[model samples]
Target: MSKYRVLVVDDEEDLCEIIRFALEVEGYSVDVVYSAEEALKMNITDYNLLLLDVMMGEISGFRMAHMIRNDPKTAHTPIVFISAKDTENDRLTAFSLGADDYITKPFSIREMLARVKAIIGRFDSKMKIGLQILSYDKLTINLEKKQVLLEEKEIRFTKKEFEILKLFLENRNRLFTREELLKRIWSDEAFVLSRTIDVNITRIRRKIGRYERNIVTKLGLGYCFEG
Candidate 1:
């Protein structure tokens, strides 16, 4: 199993180590930085999640989050704010800036670990749905505009194909049987044979070229996007 990488940004060194130790015990690959300024200087694209403290030195966690959201590379990354400020307005501001969760200071370690696991498990699905964008490396979809880009170039997909791709991206690493695909994508449409789904899947693989292997065939089990 692959471990989830987490970047924890907080001003207090002791707190950072405590969080890091706890997350490491949970089998996560953890990194900690004492300041948001330091975090901003690094390439954060590879991290699966970010735990940021809202208050810091000159560069605050909210400011860092805004910058992260504005950058296309990290725009859709999951962010959870940890801070002593627990006012309603503070939480509202965090969510408005695309925070996935807010953790108040003096939180229970068990609760924090549970929240981290839950977010990492569904972060991609939830974040993609809200932002109207699903991306895996060079492949990207603008859900609102119904656009698909491969290697920074536009790619055309039929409506059915697009929907199937969206479903796969939303539920990566989960297998879907042919019958399940037909029910979800074809719905009540009459005369749609299971073979049609196979044909569409082939076409989608061909179109994606280098990423074709990302859509994995699980022998008798079914198909899944493994990215």
Candidate 2:
């Protein structure tokens, strides 16, 4: 089997080197980038996990996590934030961004390794499950292929849009609060406003065409897929 690929994004060169050395010793294929921008330029889908620092030049790790979740190819890849920001709000922000774990700075290398192992083990098991295909009204989603078919015609969907649609379809008629949707679809909820959900839902409605009516909005509550 191939070694698990990991990307570490942090502005501190020394820290990056230490992490690279440690993870390499653990038999992982590791890549190190000093800036979030540099990490963005890479094929993020190539890595199974990302170790990100919150304070980085140009783009913060939080922003990087948002970008990753918005990309269909890397949306599901697990993220663990390692930063000095350890406040309750900060940790919540990390979890909202869909991060699997948060490791505050001044952490032990052994602890980091243990957390990484656990997160990877959990996700790997999930990936081993057989293919899943779900259909609602005229829309069909191939979970394994990450493809959507609308009445037999393949439709392109942004990663976030596809995930939103999939969640609604799978839980048909179940109301999903804006907060719930953000938690379910995004890795960094702080960056995604309630309006963002509205925008994605609008786009999804337009893409699915006639099936749009199946998605019902309950005033003062949230949205539900009634089909």
Candidate 3:
């Protein structure tokens, strides 16, 4: 079986080695980087996931995640933050920054493995749902199920969200006009306002998280979700 490729970025050499070995044993291909600088220097796009340290020399893992998110190429890559501090606020910060998962230091190899597996499984389900699935990494919209998966967690979207997603997925690579979205999503002439369309789209994007870019905006046209 081919192993899932993983990038391990941490300042501690021994910790990196241990984590690498543990993941390798779980049938994953692992690469280790001792500092954020080295991690940034390495080509990280090909990895299935990134295990990043919150604190490191020069550049912090949060900074690195911000850099990665800024670059459209790696924007959707799943990232797990590893840190010595385990405050609720830290986790909030991590998740707010688009982290798929987080693990505190002094963690068990078994727990780490479980979390890693969960994160990988989330992406796997998303990939399996692509277009026919309407997936762009973090958001999993399964047309068949009319179900949306976020970070391996299921989210119950309102009727409007589902309809909007359905339209985009059905017409991949096509640009949608605001009028089209509004007309299609709402049948009542009175309720079909331009602001309604914009509001629903923003709600969908907010819930969609990370994959928000998949729903592209055209100043004159409208939006396309199939990119």
Task: Using lDDT, give the best candidate's number.
Answer: 1
Residue 144 in model 3: lDDT = 74
Candidate 2, 1-227: lDDT as tens digits: 23699999999899999999999989999999999999999999889899999999889999999999988889999999999999999999999999999999988999999999999999988776534778875689989889999998999999999999989878998999988998989966558778998999999999998999998898888899996
What's model 3's overall lDDT?
A: 0.86
Error of 3 at 97 (Å): 0.4
lDDT scores of the candidates, listed in order: 0.92, 0.91, 0.86
Give the poorly placed runs of model 2, Cα more than 4 Å off: 130-227
Q: Note each model's CA RMSD in angstroms.
A: 12.1, 16.7, 11.1
What ordering of candidates by lDDT runs from best to worst?
Answer: 1, 2, 3
Higher-lDDT candidate of 1 and 2:
1
Score residue 62 of candidate 3 by CA lDDT: 92
- Candidate 1 to truth, TM: 0.58
Best candidate, TM-score: 3
Ranking by TM-score: 3, 2, 1
**1-227: candidate 3 lDDT, tens digit per residue:** 34589999998899999999999888999999888899888887888899999999889999999999889989988999889979999999899889999899989989999998999999988776664566555666777777889887888888898998778867877998998887778866666668888888899889877778788889988999766
Q: Give the TM-score of candidate 3.
A: 0.60
Error of 1 at 180 (Å): 31
Question: TM-score for each prediction?
Answer: 0.58, 0.59, 0.60
